[model samples]
Target: MEKITSNQNSRVKDWKRMQTKKGRVKSGQYVIEGWHIVDEAIRHRQTIKELMVVDESYLGALPVDDTTQVFIITPEIAKHISSTETPQGVFAVLDTQDYHEKIPDELQGAWLLLDNIQDPGNIGTMVRTADAAGLDGIVFGKGSADIYNPKVVRSMQGSQFHMKLFTGDILDWMAAFQNAGIKTYGTELNDQAVSYDTVKPTSQFALVMGNEGNGVDPEILEKTDQNLYIPMKGEAESLNVAVATGILLFKFVK
Candidate 1:
């Protein structure tokens, strides 16, 4: 393995750039820290561009193949590349294209559609919950938190590797799902909305979750086959978006 001791090294500088959305797009790769996500990447045989470790201590714990390029970095270099306050001392540069998948011509099984959700933690939890509920995929629309964001990746706990993820216009995807005869449901608290429990659970459907502050976009809600709301019995004005998503998503599972 090669050793990277200086933060000024060209490779280290480039890897650090992946901490931002623009940098990730420019390089066509993103960095995932810690061992759990790396294990998922290795288990799924995703195209990992590089594996960086602070020392040899983690090598035995990692599932690295002959094709993986391994690097040993000083603690300073590891801190420089990491986004978290306490660095994991290990990271991986994974090709973003490896996570891309073509949207199916027809919507099958359960799908979660996120609309402009700005919170990275919320997005990650929704993905994790969807995966746990055995949902089919998640469509991250424009304005939503970047799926490759480090915080989002950490919160997702590698559940993303278990489901299909797509990025694009949410409205277009909704139209496609509707055309495929799958019901499109949006979560919103409004007079016209019905309790989420009122709707019968089906094997195939698309659930639209909106921004944390504004709820679903009015226009997108209009496009939904039906707008549903969770019956909150508490004094709180509203539930956290991630919490609401979990409550509603599991209710959809057969």
Candidate 2:
């Protein structure tokens, strides 16, 4: 292990470069700060380019393990590598999972799909909920938030490692699921839509959610086998996407 005292170290610069979307895009890597996230990513056998820490104090804070390429730096240098306000004194540059690993073959066995959902927090929360409910995977529509975005990564609290994710066209995904005999359901606030609990799901299936204000797109609804709705018997006309997901996920499991 090599310790670096200079804040201008090239490794620090490279680590800091991963902060932006373009850098992540160009380098095919993302920054994961905090000992826990680093530990979890490593535990999941995620490729780690560098395990960075401020000093041995950070090394002492976290349990030592089979971490390769450990690098030490000054507190300011560590802060330079992280976007968070309070630097956790540790960070790592992790390789992004490829398209195949992100999208599983059996992605529909309790699926949660996002349809042009914009908010990263909402998307991340739904992924967390889907993981907790023992769902198989999550599929993000073409216009939905990026699952690999840093904000989403933080909000999910490491659910990213536990659950499978797909970030492609929902219609294409629906076709694949349908061809494989998996039923697909989408949420709608229309008169003709069936109440969510009316039909018992018998096999692998997809549960789709839509945009915050617009709801599921009609084109997507046309492709779905069932249109389901969450009955809002109270004064509130609608629910936040994450809250709605939590409620619906409970129903899906119950």
Candidate 3:
């Protein structure tokens, strides 16, 4: 174990930089905060470069594996690196390179696609929901929220470790899924969109969710096998993207 009491320490400075997308990309790593997330990382055997704690009190609670480097730091340094309102005093630096999985040669099984979904919470919740629904893969289209954003990571609650996540031009992927004979459905609220109930759930499918305000891109909708919408039956004009995704995901799962 190592001790770091100063906020000016080089490692602490690097950890602080991880809060931004550019920094994460440059370093090829991201910070995972709190015990729950760290536990999940350990469970998944993620390539954790290091474990950092603000106090020695947490030492006993760390993973039994002696191979991981653990560092004790001052509370001030922890506060400086933590993104939450209240610091958890525990965190891990995980290599982003380790999480980059190869896209399957064939796109099959249930999948979820996000097109320019900007909200971090919505993105994270959707990922968690997809994992719960046993979706095979998730694709984040261009302009979507960064998967490693602190808020998104916290909301995912470590479910990202359990699912396959990819990033690319979702429109291109749609064509690939279609070529493989996978049914791709996009959510839209226009008259051309049919009620979700009209479509029967299948073992192999792809659901495309769009930006919160604009809905699915018109062009993408046109390319889908079916444009589907949930019957609101309420005064509210729309559903939060995450909630709507949950409903559609479970529908397909059932």
Candidate 4:
């Protein structure tokens, strides 16, 4: 393991560039921190270009074996590499293409769709919930948040590596999935929108979420096979996008 002490070091500079989306894309690499996510990457056989360890605490805790290319750095250096408030004591520059997930065989069981939902934290939490609820992959449209964002990865708690994730235009995917006899549903707050629990979802279906403020777009809503709403009895008009997603996802997931 080579020691990285200077912030001016080329590797340190590259890690800092990963703080932005363009940099991640330009280099085809992103930063993955913490033990859980890295372990998940190894378990999934994802390509890890470099592992940066900070100090003795992690040095004792992390399993040492086949770190083909590794680097050692101090906690201060780790902090410089981290994006979070409290540094996780380790960081890595991972090849994004190597970490992309394969489309699951069970694309029909329960699918979660995001239609232009752009919040990184919300996207991550929703993906985490969908994984926890045993839902199928999440399909992202053009305007949706990038799942490769560092914050999204942290918010997902390594669930990102476990679930099937697809990024591209959603219209074609939706059309194809529906054509295959899989029912597709979107959430809308309306008179015609029945309570989520009241509706009986098919074994194979897609649950669609929309933009945080505007809700589902009119075009996609028009195309969906069904529309449902989460019933709110309290004074609050609606739930936070993430919370609402959790409630609605758990219903059809089981």
Best by lDDT: 3
lDDT of 4 by residue, 215-248 (tens): 9987787788888988778899988898988888
Query: Please, what is the whole-model Cα lDDT of each candidate in the order they appear?
Result: 0.88, 0.78, 0.88, 0.78
Name the Cα RMSD for model 2: 2.6
TM-score winner between candidates 2 and 3: 3
Quantify how close model 3 is to the true structure by its C-alpha RMSD in Å. Answer: 1.5
Q: Write the per-residue lDDT of candidate 3 for residues 36-72, one digit (tens) a residue.
A: 9998998898878889998878877777367778999
Candidate 4 local Cα displacement, residue 229, angstroms: 0.7
Q: Estimate the TM-score for candidate 2.
A: 0.87
- Per-prediction TM-score: 0.96, 0.87, 0.96, 0.91
lDDT of 4: 0.78
Greater TM-score among 1 and 2 belongs to 1
Q: What C-alpha lDDT, on a 0 to 100 scale, does residue 35 get in candidate 3?
A: 93
Model 2 collision count: 0
Lowest-sum lDDT 10-residue window in model 1: 97-106
